[model samples]
Target: MQTLPPMLNLNDLRFFVMAVTHGGFAAAGRALGVPKSTVSKRVAELEQALQARLLYRSSRSFTLTDAGRDFYEHARASLIEAEAAQEAVQRRVAEPSGTVRITASVPTAQQYLAVHLPALARAYPRLHVQLEVSDRMVDLVQEGFDIAVRSHFAPLPDSGLVQRPLAVEAIVLVAAPSYLAARGVPAAPGHLTGHDGLLTGVAAGTWRLSGPDGARMEVAPVPRMTVNESVVLLGAAMAGLGIVPLPQELCRAAVASGQLVRVLPDWTAGSVTTTLLMPARRGQLPGVRATVDFLVNCLQPAEPAGSAGQ
Candidate 1:
């Protein structure tokens, strides 16, 4: 019988892949929450096992050799398949008792998902949850995340993953009572141009509003400040800085507390759909299913009254 090649170390392969993908040993170490020396050592061991000089390292940079480039393509694919296999087996378990990792934008995690997690824990005491909050779109399978929550104004692109609608998010214009008292309230969408605006995302200076009867208008306001995070914009608006468009659910507490007031009550800035996404293979996993069900149950659609514009 022919003898097989020496068994490769899976951990070493993982470190090697991570180092290449992340650009350096230090970066891979930070991502893995390990020491830079550990990452370097692991990759060295992988090279020794394969009997190949995979990387050319200098004081300033490292580049993959021809052999290393060829190996990386296969190694990355193998890692993805291995993770898929692990998830497939985990899905066969009947109880939701292991760790389930989830990713969502920072504001969504803090304002919506975080509040409901305690109830989830109460329902499934044995399930451990790992929540990662970020603004970037993460590759769910590559990142080993069980689920992702995303918000988009238009239909999301077809990603081949299973998606479920969580809520229809209404975008509404808001301002602190102090701001309106000082600058005068805007009675029509056209009047928004004269107001100081606090803006976010790509639509910093522009807003599209739709009335209840489906009449639409676009207005461009001169922004006093621009920020990327909704929570920060909300804070600025509440501090009497400027009028801002925000997701209704994110500012509900402030509106209820009378810290912020709706502007142009007859028109909505726009609407977005909040969605829960997961790899199709993980749909049958007990932990994944449980988390999906929990979110669907907990996150009810925003009441018209709660949104700044009715």
Candidate 2:
């Protein structure tokens, strides 16, 4: 008789979920409250039983392979439903316990995530967040990241990963009063040629705007004093370098303090977005769903008037 390999036990399922989730063994063990070696051993056993390479590993980190992703897509939902069913009948209400791997940039973390997130952590003590901050794009499924965020002006790739609109971010042209006094404010978009330009070479050119009448108006590009990455665009604008298009969150305090002036209030560029991208498999899991929902709620645009960008 052709002997079958050992059945995938519940312990294997738990570890498999953990490894793919945390993006590495160390995080998985931390969440599972077990030794790191234990997590590694169980996943290795699970891989052996399944007769497939579940993850691609290296000394620094590990990520899921294609077959692992497929298996995860199917198994995660099953596990969540099974766990939820058991929890419904059990006296001990189990709080959501799992790992959520995230890819973000320093700007997003400092400006938005700092104040908006963390409520989720307090709500689910067992939930673990592994954040990788970089300005570059990330492969959601390959890296095993539960959620990835970016404020990109470029077109997103046609990956099968699940994506949701986190927020419709708008960039407003702002200048400090000191700058306006020194260089004088341009009355119209074309007059920007006379002003000192703070260019964030990240996306060069004149900022585009949609006016009250829904007409497309093109503002002339400003010749920059300093050309570099857009990461510090807000700081340059605050130092009165020149008028720059900044996310509302970045210029709020300056606007409130009357240190900076919002130019062309009727204009905003819809080209930018604060989006949430996640692996389709992880999106199916209960803890992943809960975290995304919570973030969406936090990113909600205020009704009419909202808080300033800090």
Candidate 3:
């Protein structure tokens, strides 16, 4: 068998590099929190392993020989690469990295995520986000999604997924100024029966509302048009098509800008609770967990300092 080279000790290489950069073993040892004798011994071992003199030592003179200069160049480069490798791994462990795939409803993605996700990017530059916008409910595990945003009137069924409630926004009836001008705004839920109704979810459904006096009723209106997407419904209402029930946040700006007006001030169409869902397995990942926490912080009220999730 061919004679194999001696195994090189990484610590010895580090000590040799430090000794050269710090001017001497004593100074290097001070920087390394070790004794000068330990630094000298390690450097000596490194030179012996390489079968080359990497440093000259005497009573009054200390310097690098021709062999030492060549070895130092390669050794310095190796140490730099090794440190860079170490830092790369430490960054992955300490900070969030890798791609996180997320799914959300069309309206939520546009109004909330698109607005807030830029902050996530600024906070963790190493992290990558893949956003999927869909109005239909997605199977988190089956669809291979890391996270999903869903809104429901009732409690979500136990689907073996971790659920985090983001917000509970009241559904309000809104109509364009033109429609309210022509159709007349309904003062009470009963008055909504005849006006042209724009609905979102089903082809035909009731507007469940409760009054300021705690009276509740459901009015099934004949649909002028129906669509499954909330954004489409918002567009229709803004175009003076008809009154549509929408999450308060979805149309707050329109209502503020005088483009649309709330039909019944005291009554709501009901509340839709938005929840963030993730697979139990996926939630355990560092990248996914950080993303979930970031979204929660953005949507919910602020918690006390240091109480933020990991």
Candidate 4:
């Protein structure tokens, strides 16, 4: 029969090492933030467990026996190794270096992450990412994704997932200058009845618009074409096919380049909030957390210039 080695109390080993290094139990207890009596009792228990006397204490001095000296050297080495092990684990937890799996809608992946992720890779050279772009509402846990970028018009339900709002993008009606000039700009929600509409998503035909004075209305525009893809709808609008309501971020570059113009400047087709979602458990990992913060910083709309210090 083989015998198992004795299992030692880690606290006892720690106390023993500290006692020797500090020259006495009292000093060791002070360094360890414990009562000397507690330290002494723990050390005594350690000696009893090991069946050996580790220290020789007299009225004049405290010294180590031959066995104690040998034990001390081994104990000191063990403690050093133990501390190094703990620090290694802690450093892994602190540093962001690992693969992070993410999911985002096609438009979001293109308009935001596609442009920003290269910078993230440059900044954290050791961090790797796997991005899955789809319009499906992915089950983050079941699908094994670390993070998800989602956009919705309403507050997400209580799904027990952690969600961080990245930005609120205004849904604006846009069209090419040629299209607007030919079809004539819709002066009000009612004026959209005759104009051709290029729409996307589930609520393709209907548009919910809020006017300048906080008045809200809904309009069902005449659909020239309806598709679930925003990029395609944007293309159709840019080709002067019709008007389309899209998130401002999607059309920002086109608007800047004069390829598209906002159809209703004083009215908006509601707003969609871009959110960062992650499984509650995965949020604790260093790499996942770092990626979340980085994406949030990159995607969130910047504050208007000169708005600070007010």
Candidate 5:
């Protein structure tokens, strides 16, 4: 009788490579156009066949067990070879052409799609995009959004969403020049407590008011007028309601126009970051890939590099 190839399955090996590369089974599943559970099962089967735990899964992190470490050392070449083979097959096909729908928050929605999209539209005339702007989270499939750009810390759940980081910007504390001159600039960060605060429902939207000797505190802002949207808060700041913590993009125009002044130039406040998220499917649609490629270029720091770049 012929002996079956030692303990591991090639398919399982493929799944393992995908998991490590993508950082999780779900992400791998999205890339492979398979259900997340299918990815999990393949990895589980591989572990059983080898009688070795390859991945140490934790609530917060994923690590390679000793066996996984050893496998990674060698299997990368095999994976690369397989990709080369696949790419050779795909090259015979024509370039991407189709309609793509993308979603974004107010700021990027206006900046990228409204202003810059014309260039992309001119390049791939056949390639069109339906743009949706909103602050609420979108269900890509249900809402028919082909891709989305938004700021978030946790990766989108394994629910058929593929997320890639773009860039991160600090949430700056800014006020109108008149407001600062009138208040004579607070003596310390704590004095900010006395100033009005613009608030939002988002976690990163919350401000950590800083003070002396690492003296720090938080402002539970109940703005006389609260807005869930970043754009609205920015408008409130421009109108001089009080101090608002905002992403650089939100205040950039105002600061340049002298409609707003950056406060506490030395002290950092909150942050705003963005990610590119898409639906999991084999052979990405033409419109989707185009947007992804452009966004990769748009969000890069010094061309491109880790975390978001990765």
Candidate 6:
């Protein structure tokens, strides 16, 4: 039968190393911010555990035995390694100097994350950001993503991840000015049927709209083009292909630039809440935390901007 190695107390070893290095119990106690008696007791306990006499003590002086010298050398080496390990971890925590892998929807990545990343990089010079843009729901832990930005109409499904609200995104009908000029703007939800529709996969062919007075209407226009990605639908709308519903944040610049104009101004095509999510474990990491804070600050400003139309 194999025998297990003896267990050693690291704290006791540390005390012994400190006592020897400081040349006396009182000095070691002062250095460690403890009572001298506590230092002496810890050293005694270490010696007892080792089953060897490690020090020679007199009222006037202190000395180390040959055995104590050998033990001290090894103990001091262990302390050095422990301190180095601690400092290595602390340095990473102090500086956000690592790759942060993020997964987000195509529109969020293109409109919000991709455009804003340069600012984050400038703020955290040592941080490397990796973005994965997709519309599929990502398994954060399984896919090794540090964070994710997700959009939802209802509450997010229970995925056991920590979620922080990023923005409440209002979906609005948008069309290229040329398209609206050619097809004429819709007076209300009922009139949208006369206009060509560029539909996203999530919306299928149906649009659910809410008016200013809490009245809801659902319209299903024949799609001239269908896309699974919001960014693609936004592009199709900007190309004067058809009217499409998009998050206001994604189309805000276009609206301001006269590339696209809001249709049915009194009615909105419902809203979806955007959230930042991460595995509970990754949420505590310094790099992940910094990225989350940066995104939160960026997205919060868009909320008021989105509501300015109302």
Best by lDDT: 1
lDDT value for model 1 = 0.86
After superposition, candidate 1 runs with Cα above 4 Å error: 1-95, 300-310
Tens digit per residue, CA lDDT, model 1, 1-310: 9999988887788999999999999999999999999999999989988999999987797999999999999889989999999897776565577889999998878877889998899988879999999989999999999899988767789999998888887788899999999999998999999999888855557887788666888888777998988889999999999999888889889999999999997788777678899998887888889989899888765533222221
| Whole-structure CA lDDT of model 4 | 0.85
Off by over 4 Å in 4: 1-93, 201-203, 301-310
Best by TM-score: 3
Provide the overall lDDT of each model, using Cα atoms, as 2-decimal numbers.
0.86, 0.74, 0.84, 0.85, 0.71, 0.85
| Model 3 lDDT, residue 135, Cα | 82
Model 5 sits at a Cα RMSD from the real structure of 20.6
Q: Which candidate model has the greater lDDT, 3 or 6?
A: 6
Off by over 4 Å in 3: 1-3, 56-60, 88-99, 114-132, 200-205, 211-227, 239-241, 301-310
lDDT for 279 in candidate 4 is 92
Instruction: Tell me the tens digit of each residue's lDDT in model 2 across 116-233.
Output: 6688888777788777888777777677788988766555677887777676566777888888888776777667666766765645565566656566666655576555545477
lDDT accuracy of residue 254 in candidate 5: 94
lDDT of 6 by residue, 129-248 (tens): 999988888899999999999876677888899988888878888999999888888887898877789987744688877777577888877679988677788889999999998888
- The runs of at least 3 residues in candidate 6 whose Cα sits more than 4 Å from the true structure, single-residue gaps closed, are 1-92, 301-310
lDDT of 4 by residue, 146-244 (tens): 999987767799888999988877788899999999889888888987888887755568887777656777788888997887899899999999989
Per-residue lDDT of model 3, residues 264-285, tens digit only: 8777776777789999999888
Going through the candidates in the order shown, the clash numbers are: 0, 1, 0, 0, 1, 0
What is the lDDT, from 0 to 100, of the residue 90 in candidate 1? 75
| lDDT for each residue of candidate 5 in 1-310, tens digit (9 for 90 to 100) | 9887674566777888888999997799999999989988988888888788889987788889988989875677677887898897675244456678888877778655566677777767667678888878888888778888887534456665787778776666788777677765765666776777776654433457543345455644434456777778888888778787776766889999999987776555644557778877712776677778877776673321112210
